[model samples]
Structure formats: structure tokens, C-alpha cells
Target: MATVRRKCFISYHHADQDAVNQFVRDFDQAHNCFIARGLGEEMPGDVINSNNTDYVMAKIRERFLADSTVTIVLLGRCTWARRYVDWEIQSSLRRGQYSTPNGLLGIKLPSYSGSFPERFNQNLSSDFPRIDCYARHMSYPSSTSALVDAIEEAYQRRTTHQNLIVNPRARMSYNRQCQ
Candidate 1:
């Protein structure tokens, strides 16, 4: 039987929806992937205001927390300040079931300015791993390959940690007997 490739849960600010959508489309074409944005019912016009931010975030969390192996945070300038983006990143970290070594990976989007957002500066001490997607995009011959490499590396780290946790006996044995 053929093995299924892992599905990635993409988290991003609504303001960066166009870039996120483009990334999703390109990534999907290049690799086996799935994205959670725009996959549900359209938001009511009345429910579109910032006052309903919590409600919108809850919906994003519900959609992303199921059947996804990785959570990729597409970081734009406005991403860090957005409440729902922050909530999603925090929620992904807190989830016991889907926890991975690199439970969260932040991808810095391409922009003219090289500086990170102020919110990110304040929250840099947090556990999420951050990588410059723009740099990676420029480094590789193709953006698709660069993204694939990033995803694979992060997934491998997560799976390796999962293996260690699930097989503590082996870890203990190696430390005591083999070492």
C-alpha cells in the first residue's frame, strides 16, 4: 500500500490571505498538501468586524486542529499583532494530541523591509521556530523545493521527538547500557 503524505495546517493573518492563498496553491501543486483557509462556509457580512475576532479565531482553531500533522504560521508584518493568529499559534502549541518537536514553524514572508514586526520582537522568547521564507525562497533554485525542504526537516524533527517519547525504554536503554 502507498503511504499518505502528511497534511500541513497553514495559519496566517486574514490581511495576508492573498499571499497565503498563492503559497497554498503553489505548494499544493509542488507537493502533496492541504490548506484550511476558505474551506468552510462564508462568513456573514455582519460577522466580518474585528469585534467578532474571538469567534472567527475559534472557527480557525476548530478547522486546523483536526487531522493535520503540521502547523505552519505564515508570518507577515501584520501577522504577529493579529489576535486570531496569536491564538492559533498558542492553541497549536497547547494541543497535547498534535504536539510535535517543532510544534510550530513561522515562515517570514517576502517584504521590502527586513525588520520583523514589533509583536514578534516582544514574543521572540516563545518556543516557536522561525525561518525566513524569503531567504529560503531566494536560496533555492525553486521556492517549491525550499518549502519542501523546510517542511520535511521540521516533520522529521517532530517525528523523531515523538518516537523518543513513545519509546522511552529505548532511550533509557541507550543511556544506561549503550553509553
Candidate 2:
């Protein structure tokens, strides 16, 4: 079967921006396997710097994630400690009147030091009865085919495992310190 190309929203920490850029350049631009959309290097100062969580989440959903069907989080060393990463994960999994929740996946980047974003883990499962999980956490893609397959799996899970999502937890107000 031919691989399906998905429109994916990349949720990642700015600290790993370089790696994320490379991944998009290699996987989407070079291979043409999927369409990658995100903030890139532009940080919308007004929205991101706001103290209101609702405002931030709304802006993120409207601008960054509106057209995406899947969310690929590039997990870096400090990703787990970032509140914005948590909000992004929450927004991706949230189902609203105008949008259905996006499929979620976590990609462990080379800078990853065995720490995972707290909110990302809420939706990801590693235990038995795997079908209950809403997200997949995997190592960085080694090839075009690997990334494409993972994206497809996430897209399929949007509906198949929608009910298993655990996104209702309280949003993180401040960044946490990772051990």
C-alpha cells in the first residue's frame, strides 16, 4: 500500500529548534512524505508571553495547529520541563467545537536524556493492553519510511483511540525542573 502523507503539527521546545528544523528539512521537504507545520523560529510574542493559559492555548490552536491532523513532539533534554510544551500537548489532544483532537506522537531527539514531557506521557501508554494508549513515543526516525509509518499510525489513532486520551489534567503554570 502506498504511504499516506499527513499534515503534521510539530510540538517541540525552542532549545531543540535546530534539530527540529533538520527533521522537517529531511523528512518533509526532502522526502515529501508528510507536511510539517509549526511556529518554526518565530515566537508570537503577544500570545506566548501572556500570563493567561486559556489565551495561549487558544492562539496555539488557531494559528499553529488549525490545519494539522497530527502532532509530532521533538523531545529534547529540557522538553519535559517546559510549560509551553505541556500546553502544546494539551492543545493537540483537546477536542473543540471547531476541531477534533490531533493524533499525538513523541519523537526522542538525539539530545533527549531519558526525560519525557509530563503532559505528553499522560496520553502515552507503555503497559499491557496497548490499545488503550492514545500516543506513540519512539526514537528519532532513521529513514523516510520510518517517519512516514509513524505519522500514519498517529493519524489512524486520532479516532481509533480518541476515547483513551487523558488531556484533562491541569495545565502546568510554570516550568518544572527535570532531574
Candidate 3:
């Protein structure tokens, strides 16, 4: 049987670049169940200052998140508060014009215990079962098999839900999301 590697879009806060760097390093050392090379850790300086929200999103969808089947959000202190992260989350769920909606999961950063993104918490609230709920999350440095299962599970769950888009923690769009 041939082993398949899922393309994973890593959604994270810039502040947690070190952790993401380590995460990618560890991923490279694994049995190779994922492909995360489309997008780099940092956005180009010109793109950062472009201030073209629509263009940026289109580029992200077509270039980076394209062909990816799952998205893993590296949860940090303020992951939910980031505008780009929010956009990424939303775009990942919607199956954009040029991109498919990737399955979702959250990985709590190593050595850090923090709350999951607010959008993912709506299901827990007594708001009559939110239509858009968050994806299940776990801690980082998890076993390759476990992480693979999570991604596969998310993929299966999406098929069943057939359009489940969870709420995002921050506003959907902005002229400038993060600095």
C-alpha cells in the first residue's frame, strides 16, 4: 500500500514563530505523513506592507493553502486574536472559489496551556448548539499516528457535516490585521 501525506496548512501567530519552526523541524523528522512546505513561516516583507487584503487572501488560497486537505492551527496565547489567522480559518472552512475547504484541527503549543480559540468554543456555550463550531484540538508533539488520525477524522467529520463552518474568534477582515 502506498502511504499518503496530507498537505497541512499551519495557521499560527507570528509571535509563536519559534514554536512553529520547531514544529516544522519535528514534522520533517517524522515518518512523513504531512507536506507543509507551500507556505513559509513568515510572509514576505513586500506582501506584509502591501495592505491589499483581497489580493493577499487570494494569493494565500491559490498559492499556500491550495492542494492542502487539512489545516492545523497552532494555538497560542493570542492565536485567535490575529486577523490573518482568523481569515485563514474562515477561508479554510468555506472552500473558496479557487480552493477547497480543508479539514480543521488545533494543536496547543508545547509547554503552554491556553484556551482554544473563541470561535471553537461556541459549541460549549449554551447558545442552542452553534451551527458553526470549532474543530477539536490537542497538544503539540503528538504521535504521528495520532496526528494523522486527527487529520483523517477531521476529514471524515467534514463529509458528514457537509458544510460545517465554525465561528472565528476575530473579525473576518481588516485593512491591517496584525503588526
Candidate 4:
């Protein structure tokens, strides 16, 4: 049997596209990665520049929603106010697909000045259950390392869940199994 490649969907504001692209490059070099922006390169010129918002959103939904096993939302300074970003997060959560120990991950991109974006504070009161959130300074060399670590951790959790499902008896038979 062929091994299934794990694909991740990246959600970010267009203003942060450069940074997001860099992250995507690093991730693709290290692991199996996919981003809707990159995928747009394959489309016809007119389709790529279409002014129809619904058509564009439908394309994004069809491609990313269907293919990706995980969604990574890159939280930038204005990310909270971006309607599309908010919609993406809400839609992903509503899909009832990705979840903790197996699904979506949220990474907060610290400002260039090595501080959390002010907007993050404003939106701190909002509730998001499916997102596994983390913050790292974009200016630090270890920023990418932190993201890589989170990805690995999420993969491990997913692997453990898969194991449990594949051999439910093993978990049930364990001496430490919950009573």
C-alpha cells in the first residue's frame, strides 16, 4: 500500500504573504506542505486574477478543504480584523474535521520588534476550541524551529490517536487503562 502524504493548509492575511511564503518554503523543504497561494500558480491567468469573491473563495474551499489534513493559521498584527482569516478559522472549526491531538494548529507570529501584536490583546477574549495556539518571535532564528517543534508534536499526537484506533484492544488491555 502507498503511504499517504500529510498536507497542511496555511491561512494568513495577504499583507503577511511574504513571511508566510518564507515559512511555506522552509516547511516544504522539511516536510510535506501545501498552501493555497502556491497552488494558485497552477490556475489560468484570468481565474487567478478574477474579481469575483465567491468564485475565489469556492476555489480555496474546494482545494484546501478537500486536500489538507491540517490547517495552520499564521496570526499577524491585523490578522484578527481580517474577515477572510476569521472566516477561514471559523469554517475550519465548523467542518468538525481537525481537532486537538490530531488537527488544526494556530501559530502567533510575534511582531518584528519581538512583542506580541497589539491586536492579539484585543481579541484575547474570544473563544477558540479547536485551535492549538503558540507564539514565537519572527525575528528569532528559533522561530522556525518552534514551528517545526509544534508540527512534530501535533504529528505525534495524531499518530498516537491513530494507534489507539487501529488497536483499541491494546489500549483497553493496558494495565493503566482507565477504569
Q: Go through the candidates in order and give the clash count of each.
A: 0, 0, 0, 0
Cα misplacement distance, residue 159 of candidate 3 (Å): 1.8
Write the candidate numbers in order of decreasing lDDT: 2, 3, 1, 4
Of models 1 and 4, which has the larger lDDT?
A: 1
| Least accurate 10 contiguous residues by lDDT in model 2 | 41-50
The residue-by-residue lDDT of candidate 4 on 9-82, one tens digit each, is 66665666677666666655554333333232221112335556556556666656555555566766555545
lDDT of 3 by residue, 1-179 (tens): 66577778888877788888778767744467677733545322223335687777777777767777787888877676667777777667764455446778888886344665555544223355544443667777558778777777766655565355655535555423322
Q: Which stretches of candidate 1 lie above 4 Å from their native place? A: 1-4, 30-59, 97-102, 112-141, 159-179
Cα TM-score per model: 0.56, 0.89, 0.76, 0.52
- The TM-score between candidate 1 and the true structure equals 0.56
Better of 1 and 2 by TM-score: 2
RMSD in Å for all candidates: 12.7, 2.6, 4.3, 13.6
Q: RMSD of model 3, in Å? A: 4.3
Please give the TM-score that candidate 3 achieves against the real structure. 0.76
lDDT of 1 by residue, 25-61 (tens): 6666445443333331221122234446456556655
Provide the lDDT at 80 for model 4.
50
What would the per-residue lDDT of candidate 2 be over residues 52-156, giving only the tens digit for each residue? 889878888878788889999999999999998888888899886766889998999999988888778877777786647888988998888888888889999
lDDT of each: 0.47, 0.83, 0.65, 0.44
Error of 1 at 27 (Å): 1.0
Which of the predicted structures, 2 or 4, would earn the higher TM-score when compared with the native? 2
Give, for candidate 3, the lowest lDDT window spanning 10 residues: 40-49
Model 4 worst lDDT window (10 residues):
166-175
